[model samples]
Target: MASAHHSRKPSGRASLPRRTTKGPLDAVDDPSLASSRHSPLPQPPQDEASGSTAQQSANPQPSIQHAQQPSVQVGEPIKEERELSFLFDTSIYHPLSQLEVPGPFRKPFLPPPTNETSVARSLEQLDALLSQCEFLRAAHLAGSILTSGTVRPTDSKTVFRLLAVRYSCLELSGNLLLAAQEAKALEDLSSAFYYDDPNVDKAEDDEVLQPHRVPHHIMPFSLRLQALRLQSIGFSDPRRGVSTLYDTAFECREHLSTPSTTPEQRVLWTERLHEVSIWVVNALIEMGDLDCAARTLETIKPGNSEHRALWTSRMILVRIKMGDMAKAHKLMKDSEFTPEDKLALESLLAVADGRYKEASEALSKSEAKADPSMTALVKQNLAVAYLYQGEVPKAKSLLEELINDGHSFQTLTINLATIYDLTSDRSRDLKMSMISQIAGLQKDQGQSRAFVNADFKM
Candidate 1:
């Protein structure tokens, strides 16, 4: 009775149609059924006025759109930066053209040789110029030879010869520093050749097929001797200078006696020996070593009239310094000298003998008018005579004249200072000023205190 009542109630509500649910197999077989089950529900048409309101409800903030706009702008710059980076990077690796590529480093260019005979001809020309005393031309020619790059090891002899001659030329031309450098090069070459065949004995016979002989120590020694002499004279150290001169003299003598010395070399050594002996004697005299000077002079036999005169004059001067006026007068009479020289010597002897009037008369009578040096010497001696005679005014006048004439000798300058000390009535300040001037002159002439003292005693 309950089931019949329920069914009668459902029929009374309305004679409703039966609703059917589709199975999976039916849905798969029917596209319309599958589409209807999967599709979204249909919505009612929205008015324009309500569309914005719905969109605003869906997204309440404008931050997302603002953020996205900035990201787009920022991304554009990032892309441009990436492109620029790629351009620079690729350009470094791959140049656009061959001209844009860097070239390899290269050395500086030196000029090529002008001709094969250029060096030889230049050397010959230099020799000719030097023989003619044309040192400037010779210097230029030597420079060309050195710069030519033709000085091979095989041509060392020629190159070394040129170097030696070049050094001499430069030295004579007053290029001391450059000459010293050249001389050092020659010394090095000499040392190298000396050790090249140290064990081998030098051949005695020129007829035999001999090894190349080097002028072992002589060349370097001579160069050093000349250098020492120059330094001594330039720097004013006669004691050391004279000692070195003596040493060089002994060496030259020893070298001359050696059996290895050839006739030509002997001639050169003898000449050098004589020259060094003369220097030794002079240096000894300058240093007040009269005994040594006399001994050294005894060893030096003069070769010519010029040498004889020179040695005799030096001997007379030494004897005069020793207060042996009798021997000085004897030497003056025996030696053949010019009229002016004899007069000068006589005046010196007269001064030593205390004959001031005779010395003054002899100095005044000297006819050395054409020679400025001799005139200056006469004036100096005359001034000395005047000082000895107590004629201070005359002595002062002569000294002042010499000073005005620019007499550069140390003796003259020292004498002037002595006269100033003895004769001047000026204040200490004036005397000091005059002394300073004389001192400056001494310094300019490279005079040492010992030299001045010696000159003063003389």
Candidate 2:
């Protein structure tokens, strides 16, 4: 059989007999295996093979389960892969290429240059404006220049002075809160430039040897003192304001006496001291410290006719308040007062001496060309005169006008009550009503007294 098995291949087509090795189906023929070996394994249908190749190219990563599944049925993974590719191509890839990077920070604008001539011209203009009492315009101009940042640091004294003037203007304009803020800024700037250690002794031991040395400390000190004075006034602390003015006056006197000071500088400081002394005296008189006001006035020797007139006027007013009518009259006679001031003083004297008709005539004569504040004051004094002279109707008309014009309700109510009390029993109810109104007004004003005890002569 082995020889026959070998010899069977010699024929063109030969049949081989199968041998049974074991029990069950070992003799069965495997015709499919034989055909697989003879042919090329019946290459998968051409279209199906090409589809599989294309699906694999679309998604390089193929899972075993995915490979086993048919391509048409496995649609979710292919859609997801296409969407992810689209998003990556749109936003995530090369993101920075489309943006613009910013450069370093720089100032948007620069201020104009300030030269000495320009600064002087501006200061001259400011002075002219101040002299003309164009305070708002001056303040606006100064503020613009200050905020422009064009002034040199070494030449900041002029700017500070302008700022001081601006604060004064604000105070005069009745913007007390804004004035206080500006005063604080001036104080800070002065301190930054000129503050010295208080614990250190600044007194010179050999004053004669340094007589020729220029005193550089006066300007900044003056500015700081003025700022403090303005701040105190704005806060309604008149005593503190007066004290600060006194300090400034003393400092100016000392600076004026410095042997190294130029003639021009001496004149400037002397005038400043005089002005500050006048303010001190005025503040003392306002506080009813008559003795102090007199003492302060005596310290200032008048150097000009105008100053003499001012001094005389203040002294006369003080004497009038102290009930020294003879001395007040003597001073008024001796003083060369302007016609308006003379009229005001005469009216005050008449009011003090119970000459209501004379006082009313003087006030009316003076009211022809007065400012609004002065007019109000004249009206108030005239009403008081009428009330005292048994002219209840005229007093009532003036008081009602004042109340309608939003003057002090407490004052008007008190005056009305006084007038009603002096009248007949026909106005007894009206008197009670006026008294009640006075009480309410006082309560609203937070005044401790029912009637203001201040003398209204001025």
lDDT values for all models: 0.47, 0.46
Model 2 C-alpha lDDT per residue in residues 195-238, reported as the tens digit of each score:
22221333566554455332233244334544665566556787
> CA lDDT of 448 in candidate 1?
24
Point out where model 1 deviates above 4 Å: 1-208, 211-215, 218-223, 226-247, 250-267, 282-289, 367-370, 406-409, 425-428, 431-458
Off by over 4 Å in 2: 1-158, 188-192, 195-214, 217-226, 234-243, 286-288, 301-307, 321-327, 333-341, 363-458
lDDT string for model 1 (161-222, tens) is 55445555554433545554333322221122222332245555742645343223322333
Error of 1 at 175 (Å): 22
**Candidate 1 accuracy as lDDT:** 0.47
> Per the 3 Å backbone cut-off, how many clashing residue pairs does candidate 1 have?
0
